[model samples]
Target: MRSCIPNVLLVSLLSTSAVICSPAPSAPPSKGTTIPLTRRSVHKRSAAEWDEWAVRHREYVTKKYNGQVKSKRASGMNLLTDQDADSDYYGSVAIGTPAVSYNVILDTGSSDLWLASSSCSGCASSSGGGPTSAASNSIPLFDPASSSTFKNLTTPFAIQYASGQATGTLGQDTVQVAGFQVSDQTFGVCDTANGVLSSPLSGLMGLAWQSLASSKATPVWQTLAASGQWDSGVMGFFLTRFGNDSHAKELEPGGQFSMGYVNDSLYTGSIDYQNVPSDQVAYWTLPVTSLTVQGKSISLPTSGSNQYAAIDTGTTLIGGPSDLVQSLYSNIDGAQAGTGSWEGYWFYPCSTSVSSSISFGGPSWSISPDDFEHTQVDSSGTQCVGAFFEVNTGDNTPGWIVGDAFLKNVYTAFRYSPPSVGFASLSSTALGENGVDGIAPSATIGSPAAVVSSTGKASSNKNDATRSRGFSVQILALVWGAAGGLLLA
Candidate 1:
């Protein structure tokens, strides 16, 4: 029978995290001891299995730099922000049928843990669609009613993103992932949410610093390390889209999301760091060396607007005020303007003139020409498409933030211990090892151009059918194991 999750063979998983959901429960282990996850390093799982990993990591994404921005320091550099500080990053910790794992955003920012809940209310399923294939029907679910470990937490919940926002319940449950397991762990869940959300994602799990986590006893990452599940408290990630073409293609065989770092990765050699100002305790504000339009460097308002550039791993596009973006796009050859919508920013052109790039930090990396092209039918029955930025006439300082769109070229690193971040790039071979498969393997996007298009939006819609771990291991393990005990009772 056809199945959406083909290689997710560890066991039954229950959630289909299209836009939102979570659950809770607990069960005694079969052996009375936890089993560490087999995955800890990169490129270990096969292609299909890696895809399964990405599906589960959704709840664990976090913002690189988070905090309160004083208007005085609010320079032109767009910082990361969510209307609701608590729920900004999309990350999660989930207990699936086969196993419990950490599903977080492969963000450049910080990393931590948040789990999905058993009480999630999902979107209505299509009634007319073909019935679930036998394999598809086997996904598991986590039921908290029978488990004693599930506990509702007091942390208030909310998440705000430039793209959209998610609101839900917060609570603590048993969680095991990437070889770590902790009882009474805290996480957020949005059972029924209404906000502008990316179609590809269902729930988020934060992995940044402890500040982003709802769990009070221990930060998610530290908890994992304490459990002796991780090699170290350190977490490694290689985002697929930011690398060169050939390496990115190989990333598909490598699942878009997997734990641990790529082996022997390269860096710019220098580790440039700026501590987050106390006033902006949550976010690490970085200084802008300069601004450039195409290959030519341009003048900016300078002194006032250059204070902090919010490095966010959650966003797919780079966002900045219209005045700044206007000058930047003007320099890219073949770029034109188009209609604007929250669906996404629009640019003009038919045969996309790509390979152009916007440089930051200290490198002259090239932007792929093909990364910005799209084809749409004009009134003349001709197809038209181009770069991805739609000027938001409605708002200027509408949080002009840089997204993954711009950061992909740099070898981005997040150092949470000091609350600072670092950047560099990897070799071609390394890029091939870390991408595409982590996000979604079925997608065939090429560079920024393909991803920027509405087609990418449609592809993300399919995420709705993605499944949650079917049954709670802790719950089922105890229930089935106690059948003999029930008879004795």
Candidate 2:
């Protein structure tokens, strides 16, 4: 939910060999369409700040669904404070009649589409009460008054997070993305948002099902799928990496987000599909059959909710049940539990190759050592934080949150028709520095090649592959003006 991008929704027609676009072609629509995603590196913060943010984030998420807090602001807490920023990968979306664009994070963990209103109380242009970060100043606010078709529903809208919150009113308008437009799409127009909008990002676009939407509105993708706009009810992601590259830019090409079909060239071999259990169909939840460290299987919770996992693109870290997480690190020599501000976290030697894999009733997919070994935890340049964290979601929610740490290792597809998730190995060309090729070799306690710098950046020797090509489509582009008219491309 913390990523960034612009608001122009680029729709692409996909084929087997190359990506090309035209204006108003006669060919039928392809099976799938794609949108380009941009990566925004987070501003640096202390490790303690990150730890504190994580704790609060878990509490907020837990409370949100526990019925402890209503969808509207039940705690009268004013939205303030700067939440620690996480590395974000987002894209553009255009809403309203005039087709104004806004950058939004594409999140699968939660379902709700919202934009910061131009009349936001905490915005820099409004009364002072929001984050004063320079990045927050650059975020564009959506002015519902400017859109001729905007309709206020008069329903209260509010969602509270650990360090920030957004409170506003529900509205209906035309929501456009990937060349498809949904008329009267219900979304929140926040009059006040705190610590949410960052530069180049004005809102969040949730991709999960309607059951999880706080607004009680059907998600954009589900709307499209129900309308038969896509040949197949499926969406796929191939997330790229830039954190390890010393020469990484602020806005790099993150990866592709495909709708309706999977790009054959992006992944290798056949995809292993896992059906979502009936009880966990709200999100992309799958049963985690097994977990292994150094090629040795570890004991997992046999009963209760600990076996289920939600594959979330919004989250940056891999999280599991407390006991399972402890068992995972116990296999790695020199691994130790973090103390004080870093409780529920673990750290290991920087040079340790902590090769790991997770299974979802299919072929085991390996996690890269580079992904497992996170940031540096010690000034002596020895201890490094592990990407895996401990989450106590209780027995009602999924016990595991499989996030970018494990996601970047494989090409993932979310199918709507049958409610299943699939994973495939990345093709040779698609495999970057941290991409997994196959089942990883057993981990070594002191592997020199896996050693990172004092700053915890990956070695410069790792190959940074060329980014995947952007997709395009041939359709009549909709150009809207204040006069409420559209011009065909």
Candidate 3:
């Protein structure tokens, strides 16, 4: 059942992480244009410290990495094994390829799946300071030339993010997810684009550690549903960033990715599958029970407004109505700073003392302390750190993105679209339909709270090739005209 619970306090939730695949090709980077961020006042730092600053001033890193931000979701087609020239990130079903390996982006927003074209010249848009090359660079791009399953939907797709857009072509391809490969799934091929490329990540394979996403697909969770594999239910993820030892904290080369829980960690409750408006321009609108500042409840303008919220996995931050943010910032001491803090975006006062936790929603779902205070500092010897994002779609802009900044803390589930419009997961995950456990927050990762709702039932748009990027709604006119022509004949 696609459900959206406002004011109803469901049980609190918890969380779960990882990446897996074949050996990657040795593709390296070809340098390109880069934008230098030089702030005499705030020096850049390392990933460690950045993690700290993440909790204090979220606007910092997202703004800092503004130029580097991009979007991707898990994507693939038929599970046939072959000798294809693909990398671990972009795997192929070939004799030489061995088995199924994928390239996916860990997202915390909307649930959707898609891929990039092996022939994507779109990556050429990088400004000289382009992506780091690797052996996989030689792998055949998502070339329609190699696969007969590729079908031109004649559709343009673009996911606009706070930093940039992941634009591409929407087509039907045989996709593989969670070991189950589908004959036809809606996938995207980035033919033209701008922004992103800090690493070799091209397509996003989302099962974010949040709800709602920066783009149309939302997250891999949604894409799988559209694909027939796991189409009956929403998916889940576990984000583990910690290490067994301090020295072991290095990012695994090429890394491992997954769609559901990996560890025994438990969750607290069910998923809130709020139905997004089917008009393509839809969003999740849940009620705000309250916004507490420094342990005190602050008032917001969200009351009675069909608060439009986007669950974004591609984003690391959470942004929305000023009132919601203001309340959150005020509760924490060093969470907000001056206009100079986030370059005037929004920030925690530099002098504000950091608080342990900030509460929200009705009394039913209360956000915890540690989850609200996660951060990653920078390499510089200064206070600059790695903070993800929290943004406004603009004044009266109808949608707000609640990103990983929120999801990394809790367990979340998305009930597939059918009898209802939602999903479920427990704060402990022990209560969900799946017997899997939720996340056990270590010194490594973030905490929880969720996109509260219950179920979702959405119509699959397989023949939606006309709904691609740049096409606008004019295709609908063409469809109508064709229908008229057929009638006249």
Candidate 4:
């Protein structure tokens, strides 16, 4: 889930002929580009704050899944406000004419693009000048009136979440990101945004398929793919970990987002690709073939629909069926399930090193032990919350929502041409301090062959071989702090 809800909202756009919006060359470049993501941190949360965020986060996940099932699309998204835990990653994108760049969350769970307008009602304000750090409680607003190419689509946009909502008007303008430009891109410009946006982060850019878009607008990525601008319809992510780093700063380099190719330096061995089921095309939904805890295989639901898991980069935690979650934790010593206010969660002794892994029709990828330990729960710091929580959608929605907890463990790639997801073992440098918990020495890392499609065919295209013709947007990862509050003016 994004820090903001995925509610329906509207925005307007203006045109620009700036250098950033220059036309693409006759031939598109083939090489993939990289974007840096920043990981922001906030002051250590009290037990109460953690509890509040957990409750709200659970509610948001429930609503997100339930809404998707009922509507055949994600109805709303839960965005983490500044007051919540700091776990989201952000990248910058320039919109409108003259190219005003704003920091937006790059999410794969939904489809839609929205930004705060200059006239936004409750949006947070930046401290003037550009943001110095991820925690810099600053946001740059987009003024449609300043762009000569701006055009109002006259569509009302609104999205509601468990915490807040953003409502505005839909419009079109040129959008530039990762060195690619999409002209007349449809997006939202909010006039009333409360709880939906946070400081230092102005908007969200959903990278899912168009069918999931609430505004019925083609996502910037899809637009790029349709225009043959992408060398390959592949985007990969390498999310870094900072929770356990004592020397970590409020704004620190997090990871990389690769467009059109995979960065071999980020991971080792060959990539394991899993095809997204045809019917489950809305999100990057894949079937979980198996799961294990402490080297013991845990029984999973045999029902096809119940085994699906959505690879969500925007979400900070891993959520699964209540029974499975309970069973997994039961394998850990001193693990206790929460009750009442803490229901749907699990807690364990801080000293326990929980080792777990999951598979998607390929080699099982190990999750780092550090990722399992979410945060310290008690004042004495003897107890800690488990990153894996219960997400009971009550319907035939994907049984798991795999977020950063699991994603940070591997180098993940999403392919559009064949609608598949791939996972590879992280390189030594990318793995850093938190190595794979209990991955067996015999575990196969696959072969460095072409990516396999869902139909069992090998993909011949090389994502990194060709270079894009124009300037590329390097997506860098940075750490940011949450806004003070969702102030409504």
C-alpha lDDT of all candidate models, in order: 0.32, 0.58, 0.31, 0.64
Question: What are the per-residue Cα lDDT tens digits for candidate 2 across 389-428?
Answer: 7767645667887877787789998888788999999987
Top TM-score model? 4
Worst 10 residues of 2 by lDDT: 442-451
lDDT, model 4, position 66: 67
lDDT of 1 at 215: 31
Candidate no. 4 TM-score: 0.82
What's each prediction's TM-score?
0.56, 0.77, 0.53, 0.82
TM-score of 2: 0.77
What is the C-alpha lDDT profile of model 3 across 8-102, one tens digit per residue? 10111111011223332122112111111000011123343323223322342223122211222222110100000000111112101112222
RMSD of each: 15.6, 14.1, 17.0, 8.8
- Order of candidates by lDDT, top first? 4, 2, 1, 3
Please give, for residues 190-268, the per-residue lDDT of candidate 1 as tens digits: 4432222111222334444444333323444444433332222234333333222323221122112222222233343
Better of 2 and 4 by lDDT: 4
Better of 1 and 2 by lDDT: 2
Candidate 2 has an lDDT of 0.58
